[model samples]
Each structure stands twice: as C-alpha cells, then as structure tokens.
Target: MQRFDGRVALVTAAAQGIGAAVARRIAAEGGSVIVTDLQEDKVAELAAELGDRALAVRVDVTSRADLDAAVAAGVERFGRLDLLVNNAGACVVTAMPEDTTAEEWHRQLDLTLVSAAQSIQAALPHLLKTRGNVVTISSVNGLAAFGNLEYSAAKAGQLAMTQNFAARFGSSGVRFNVVAPGTIRTPNWDNQPDALDRLAKLYPLGRVGEPEDIAAAVAFLGSDDAAWITGHTLPVEGGVLTGPSALDLTPKGPFRKEQ
Candidate 1:
C-alpha cells in the first residue's frame, strides 16, 4: 500500500524466511531495503530478485565490524536509514540447562541479543537524524517459559534491549519496539518435528503461523500508523499465552474448529 514510500529499511537475516519476507513487504510498499545476512550469496540472490529496490550486504551480526560495514553500505546506497529490522537470530534446538555449555550459551546470546544491540548501536546516529524506528523479531518465549532455555533467555534480553533503546532514544526521535512471534513456519522449523507439533498444539489457532503474519505486524509497527507505538512487546502468537479452554475440562483438545 506504499505505507513506506520514500523510506529506507535495513533488515538483518534477510536472505530467506521471515527476514526475506519482511524485506520483500517493505520493498513492495516502496521502501528501499538493505538485505543483510551472513549468507552473502543468498542475500545477493534475493537482492537481485528484488531488483534495484534492494541492496545486499554480508554481515555477521555478532561482529561489530560487520554490522558497521553493513550500516555504512546502507547509508552509502540509500543515503539515510529510516528503519531497522533486527531480524537475525538463531536457536539452540538440542541443548538443556545442564547440557548448555558456556560456549553454547554465549553463541546463542551473541547471535540473538548482542547482534541486535550492535546493529542498533551502529545505526543509532543515522536513525536519530531521520527519527527512524527499530523493530526487533523477538519470540513469545521471551515473555514466558519455553523449551529452549538459551533461546528464550536471549530473546528476553532482546525485549529488554528494545525497551531500553526506546526509552533512551525516545527524546531523540528514535522509536524501538519488539514483535514476538509464536511458532512461525519458517525454514528453521523444517526438521523440528517435535517442536512443530508442540507449538501447533499450544496455539489456539490450531495451526502454525506464517512469516508474512509476523512481517505484516512488523510493517505496521515500522510505519507512521504505529508512530505512537514504542517500547511495547506485541505478541503475534495467535492466542498461545491466553491459556487453555475452561469449558472443555481437558488438558488438551482442538481449541476451535478449523475453517
């Protein structure tokens, strides 16, 4: 709908899946997008697919230098950054508390939490100049307990960072918010059969969410329509946190009939 016309957006992990979907939506709405990811080839390919509206940059979110380079590239190409989507994140699919070594914990934290912080830090000055906004792709697990402890912890940290940035930059005209998706159907879910089933059951919608579902919320939050929305953790979880039905009197059942 051209909601982002004349704007510039920088989206991390934009090579595929949710990040790619977000980038595509922003571009479709007339926003110039910088697609960043560690997968250089994939990002380049997608950028090409998006044509001149997008620029591809290789960035390892955990590396300050990489993030700096990415921001610099965006400013160089687009002249200014109007929005930042911290969509880069990874999960630990096979580790429990006892099994999660320090290295593993740091790996998860660095990719999910610290990476976004670094990107924000690098892009803050440009964002300040433009009075831009930041949208972080956190998870529902950030607010409540979930199976992946390390991932949840990292996402919680991201949510906290979003609030801190929003409060700190509010006066400077920079807005920050978090979008917490429940169980989105992305490539990350490809081999996670157990996780898929569990999440599908937990969601009252009786199905997994789509990347566009999350992206649509992000697009709104990043637009002028959401100018008043900042420092909020918006859950796009399809009623997962609303608890089970009381009338059923059973621990589990199809919450609603499928349409």
Candidate 2:
C-alpha cells in the first residue's frame, strides 16, 4: 500500500471527481502529490485535506507556462517527480459529431488531447530523472461507440500518445500507460441522475464505476507493481466494453435534444 513512499506525482485536474480521487489515493499511499487544476480554491481545499504531502497548483493544462510552472513547483517542493497523472480531459463538445463545428472540435482536442501532450513534455525531464511513469485517464468511449465523438477521439489520442511515449522512453526507464474508464458517478452526472441509472443496466456489472475505482487502477499503473507494463490501455469499465449493450448512442438517443 505504501509502494509510493518517497515518490512524487503530479496530477492534472485534481480539483474534483476522478482527479481528486487519484490525488487522494496517491497521498494516502505515502506519495507526495502535486495536485493541479484550473479551480484554484478547489485544489487548495483538496491539498489541505491531503495534508503536507500535497501541493495545490492552479495549472491551466492548455498553457505551457502553467504546465511548466506546475512541474517546476512540484519538483521544487517534493524534490523529484515520479508520476504524471494525465486526468485533465473532458467531453466539452456536446454537439453531434456531424453538426459539431471546427472551433468546437479544436476546443475539445485542445482540452482533452493537446493539454496531455503538453503536460508530458513539461514533466518528461523529471520523469526521466526518477525513472517514473505516467497513467493517463482515458475513457472506454475511446474503445467503443459511446458517443461524444470529439471526446472519444481525443481519448483515443491519449492512448496512441501513451504508446508512442512508452516506446520512446521505455529504454530510458520511463513508462506510459492509460486507464480507459466507463461512465462514473461524478458531478458531471449530477444533472443526469437518471442517465446513470439507465446506463448501469447496460453494463454487465449491473452498476457504474466510482472515482475510487479509477484511482485504484491508476495507483497500480503508476506504482512499482506495474513496472513491467508500458504502452498499454487498461479498460476499467464495468464490463461495458465486453459486448453490445442497450445504451443508445444514436443522435436520436439524447444528444440531439442536448444539442
């Protein structure tokens, strides 16, 4: 449980939900975590809850300056960087794929994909120094037709990016992997309370996932236990990816109304 003792991690989007859970898990296991998010107050509250081992940084992942400052701050405080949890992505584009505009697509990619790459670049030097690893929070949507075209595409990009980074840095003792999750009961679902109830029926596990479920997988991937693993995507879905389900992803399902 204390596998991360003496290690340090930098987690993006650590203000709430899965990001917050991962930050809590890492800190609980004796890892010093740099918890960064655009929500300054939220991350600061989380850091306070996590105690002295946690540092709150308001990092706009889209900005290289913010990413660089966060990485620098973590290193300067924790003394070294051992893990980079790329958990900042989101499904910002609600429009149907065909009707989605170029600007929206760019914005989606900027938030969900490009920012991840920028964070890696900002942390690579420190990761290289510590022989550390990265655990990117992708989505099962990336592996299947879960709708949210822009989001899924961006999530899939994280997988490919991790693979390439793994292959490029494995020899240097740096690892990269992804955890693709199914629908979770995050604040994003607060308004769509019924949607999760309906979606759970489609999953073989008969329920949805929790942020802790993802944090557990992230802990494994970012820890020494998964030292031999690299360039892979681990689906932490509630067996939803096993086969077809009753979940309707068609434009007429719910997206058209939201659009």
Q: What's the count of clashing pairs in each model shown?
A: 0, 0
The TM-scores, one per candidate, come to 0.91, 0.93
Cα-based lDDT at residue 233, candidate 1: 94
Model 2 whole-model lDDT (C-alpha atoms): 0.92
lDDT for each residue of candidate 1 in 1-259, tens digit (9 for 90 to 100): 5899889999999988899999999988899999999899999999998899899999989899999998999899989999999999988675668887899988899999999999999999899999999999999889998779999999999988899888888988889999999889888777876787666766677777899998999999999999998999999988888964233456485587669
lDDT scores in order: 0.90, 0.92
The reply for model 2, stretches above 4 Å from the true place, is 244-259
For candidate 2, the 10 contiguous residues with the lowest summed lDDT are 250-259
Off by over 4 Å in 1: 192-198, 244-259
Candidate 1 lDDT (Cα, 0 to 1): 0.90
Query: In order, what is each prediction's RMSD in angstroms?
Result: 4.3, 7.2
What does candidate 2's lDDT look like per residue over 161-243, in tens digits? 99999999999999999999998989999987699988888887788899999999999999989989999899999888886
